[model samples]
Target: MTFLETLLDPFQYQFFIKGLVAALLAGGLCGLIGVFITLRGMSYIGHGLSHAIFGGYAAAPLLGIPIVLGAGLWGLASALAINAVTRRHRIGADAAIGVVTTASFALGVALLTKFGNKGPAFDSLLFGSINGVSIGDLLLLGGVFLGTIAIFTVLYRQLLFSTFDPEVAKVSGVNVGLMDTILMVVLSMSILATLSIIGVTLVAATLVIPPVVARMLTDSFGRMLWIATALGTAAGAVGMYLSYQLEIPSGTTIVLVNAAVFLVVLLLKGAKGLGRTAGLDDHTDASATGLVTASAPTRA
Candidate 1:
């Protein structure tokens, strides 16, 4: 069936509709923040936050709290802890990520013993069942996505500058540290928003893969972000289809589909670049560097 026909011939399945909505919101948010994640070469942080979200997820059942809210706080705390440790102790981002995320997640798992009889549902945080998604989840996703876009509108130039060249950004009067911290919070929040739809485990793929794909196609950072957002949305929708037909987890299916697309686009674009640079062995040394370059964005 055509795309229009498939969507129009709805089975009146409210759950299916919910799943689609969830994917769209989650995918869009991940794609947007992913622009920064990719530019900064900090894909590992996204991976760490995705898993660290389990801290909040584990807290919900025991403390009689909402998992998303708990996870958001968990993510924020994890980000701060990582930043502090890395700053004060001369630890790196990767090492800090391992220490904070694993520790927080382990604590969450350990605290489960106190809430006897009210066993925490495993899938609530790990493997999201689309049917369990409520209207509140949709609202939270919408709020985060819109808020992120608004913030980006105001700070895009600064973020782009800092991501491309922290030293220049600092010298040029941009608040690189403050911008970095705020972006970290936004990223942690984005990961939390997507955790319900993509699950804590699969969020890294949704965030990193889309931007990675976009980077191959565009030389300009702003254009790359928009392209990444589009790719993410497409992957999200296709993932929903994969989940429905395969009788599998929607979030996992979505993430896997995204990964496949990323691989395909990367190879395709890389080949195209090589083909163009084939004969220019000495003359077009610039083009041989391919599309990726370190020309920093200018701050406003």
Candidate 2:
């Protein structure tokens, strides 16, 4: 077969089409949210929340609940719990994340051990199954993507202010707490929606890698958002095609693609320069146009 014929072979399968669209939506969504996550130093939240939501994934079927609603609610509650724990206690955000997510993941493992795997295939949930993605999954992904864009549009300034300087944002009457909650809720939605395609094990890579690469490429927050989104969307589509060609796990392949991009960006930017750019540094332009120059405050 010629190169074009070989590449076009997968299009004959409906599952491939669904999976590809799901991946594209997931990648772009993660990229958009990842900017906030990395900027606020909440990178671990993506990792932690994905694990925490696994408990819900394991439980929803047993309890006769819809996977989307059940697991999504569980993820949201866990996120809120982490936020509350951090605020009300002396424990740091990292510590709270470790505690909450580990316990939740443990619950998942325990349930699986006691009751056996139910709902979906055991391996597919952990490692992802592109062929398993259904029409419903695609709809959920699209909905979450649009919802995230709407939220970001309506609260752009508020989120930006709270992200860089929560204290100042609060003093300026930005309702920093509400902004935090909004972000957590949207993040929960994003993770829950993308869980099926990226799987629990590899989702965090999609969230972190794209934004980090974007940061290395640009100093402007607005540009970072666009660059990250574009990279993620491209990674998703390209990774899907590559996974089909290579006969590998889709989620793993997608993550490897992101990692490869990260490496290339690191090499191009140079180690010293990447270090300088990737680290949270003060920008010179702190304007309403989404160019933030202030050093972001540590979130707990």
Candidate 3:
């Protein structure tokens, strides 16, 4: 087969096409939210919340409820609980996260062991089954993507201010507490949307790795968001294609691809730093003069 034929092979099947769309949407949305997650150093929240929501998954089938609905509610409640506990009790954020999330996960495991029967397999829930995405899932993802864009568009300034400088934002009447709540809610929604695509085990990586990679590539937040989204989409698409070709698990392949990209960027950054050091060594006198000039003060 030719290159184009090989590339287009997966598109011939409806499930593959759906998986492609689902992967891209999941990756892009996670990447978008990941910027804030990274900036606020709340990456653990993603992991914690993902695990916490597993309780809903464990209980849903036994209760004759939709798994996504149950999981989403649990995830949202977890986010709110974390926020409330850390704010009200003066607990460390990490400690709050660890306590609540682990408890939720433990509850889930217990519930599943006791009540789960011939429902969705734990493997699919934990590891993901992107190729199993349905049309309804696609619609849900689309709604989430649009909702995310709308929220960010409407609250960009407040969100940015709160994220980088909460004290200043609060002094400026930005409602830092409300902003935090909003961010947490949005994060919960993002996590819910990503659960099926990447599954609970690996969804947090999707929410983190892309932004970290983008941070390595740029200093501008705007550029960081765009770069991260693009990198995530690219990783998902490429990973999906690679998984199809190799018959590997899509979620694992996607994460591996993301990690591979991160490693490449790290190497490039290191090389660039080395090159700058070499250039500085070659231009020691010029560098000293420039440094002195840069440090000089001017009188108005």
Candidate 4:
């Protein structure tokens, strides 16, 4: 077969097309939301929420609820509970995530052991496969992707303020708590939408890798967002094609592609790039001022 024929072969299958679209949507969505996630130092939240939602996935059938609805609600509740615990108890967010998510995941395991894989397919949910994606899953992923774009566009200033300097944002009447809650909600929704395509185990890698690579490439937050989104979109499309050609798990292929990109960027940029990106947390407020634009309070 010619090169073009090779590229076009996968298009013959409707399933491949659906899976590609789903992968593209899920990857880009994770990239967009992941900026705020990493900036706020809550990188673990994606992993945590994914595990927590698994509990709901297991319990939904027993409760006679649809898996999507039950798992979504459970993920949202877990996000809120983590937020509440961190704020009210004066403990570390890491500790709160560990305690809550592990317990929820343990519940999922117990349920699976006792009841069986009564929710979705066990291997698919854990490792991911494009063959299992349905029309409903595509619609859900597309809807969530569009919703995320709208949220980020509308709340740009507030999100930037709260992410970099929550105390300052609150003092400037930006409603830091509300912003955090909004992020948590979006995050839960993102994880729930992506679980099937990316799998619970690898979802966090999709969320973290693109943004981290973008951060290494740029100091400006605006540029990072654009770069990360582009990288993530490309990774998804390319990874999906590669997975089909190689006959590997789609989720594993996507994550491996991301990791490969990260290594390539690291090698090209060297230690200086890594060190500079590492220090962003310290200078994020001052360095990222240009991101929030004129709408941001001058006081901030």
User: For every model in order, what is the number of clashing pairs?
Assistant: 0, 1, 0, 0
Q: Write the per-residue lDDT of candidate 3 for residues 1-300, one digit (tens) a residue.
A: 999998788889988888889889988988999888877778889999988988877877778789778877888899999999988997988899999999999999998777664455677667667566888778888898899889988888777766766665676677879988988988888877777778788888988889888766755667778988998899888877777888876778889999999888878897653343232212232433343334332233
Regions more than 4 Å wrong, model 2: 281-300
Instruction: Please write out the lDDT profile of model 4 over residues 1-300, one tens digit for every residue.
Output: 999999899999999999999889888888888888887788898999999999989989888999999999999999999999999997899999999998999999899999888778987888678898899999888888888889989888888877877777778888888888998999999999888888889999998999999988888888889988888888888888888999987889999999999999999999976875674456454568655544576553
The sequence of per-residue lDDT tens digits that candidate 2 reaches over residues 187-276 is 999999888888889999999989889888876788888999999998998888787888787888899999999999889889764764
**Per-model TM against the reference:** 0.85, 0.93, 0.87, 0.95
How many angstroms is residue 220 displaced in model 4 relative to the true structure, after the best TM-score fit? 1.4
Candidate lDDT (C-alpha), each: 0.74, 0.85, 0.79, 0.87
- For candidate 1, the lDDT comes to 0.74
Overlapping backbone residue pairs in candidate 4 total 0
Clash pairs for candidate 4: none
Supply the global lDDT for candidate 2.
0.85
Question: Which candidate, 2 or 3, would have the higher lDDT against the true structure?
Answer: 2
Roughly what TM-score does model 3 have, to 2 decimal places? 0.87
Model 3, residue 254: distance off in Å is: 1.0
Clashing pairs in 2: 283-293
What TM-score does model 2 achieve against the real structure?
0.93
Span of ten consecutive residues with least summed lDDT in model 4: 278-287
